[model samples]
Target: MARLESTLMAFRAKNGFDRGIAAPQIGVQNRFVAIHLVGKHASPQEDALPQAESELFQHELNHLVGILAVNLVSKDLLSADELLNRFPSHVI
Candidate 1:
């Protein structure tokens, strides 16, 4: 766990944009992930729940197989309102 945290920190320091990392990314067979949300925004209180936590974990889990969130988006970009209107809450 300590190594994973340090690896993630080092990666963010070097690349300047990574916020999370899956253990498999560094050859760790353990099922785990390290995430740093220090400078990021939290979900609004109006949300039914803090969706970002679940969403981010799910996003990172995909990295176990080398997949990414962008690979799951089936269409072009859409605004938040558009997404809410087009898909069910679970899909967003």
Candidate 2:
């Protein structure tokens, strides 16, 4: 968890995101974290729900990084865990 936090910090710095919340910190169970609001627009109030932010970040990142196929496939009756169980190889 410490290493994950450190890596997330490094990623934020490298991307110039400057946002405090990251995806892996929550329960997204993947390497991608989505950052919606950034820079001066972000605040403590906006960040009150870190888990939601992380989930949203992961959703957006999935879209950006070409996970649409998996997303689409998972949109059916499958729960998130079920989808993951069906395609564990795509997690990273």
lDDT to native, each model: 0.78, 0.57
Global local distance difference test of model 1: 0.78
Model 2: per-residue Cα lDDT over 29-88, one tens digit each = 665543435434446667444565565665656644556436566345867898699989
Off by over 4 Å in 1: 39-49, 65-67, 70-92
TM-score of 2: 0.28
Q: Against the true structure, what is each candidate's TM-score?
A: 0.57, 0.28
Looking at model 1, which ten-residue stretch has the lowest summed lDDT? 40-49
Off by over 4 Å in 2: 18-54, 57-70, 73-92
Query: Which residue pairs show backbone clashes in model 2?
Result: 34-57
Question: How close to the true structure is residue 39 of candidate 1, measured as C-alpha lDDT?
Answer: 53
Local lDDT at 22 for model 2? 37
Note the clash tally of each candidate: 0, 1
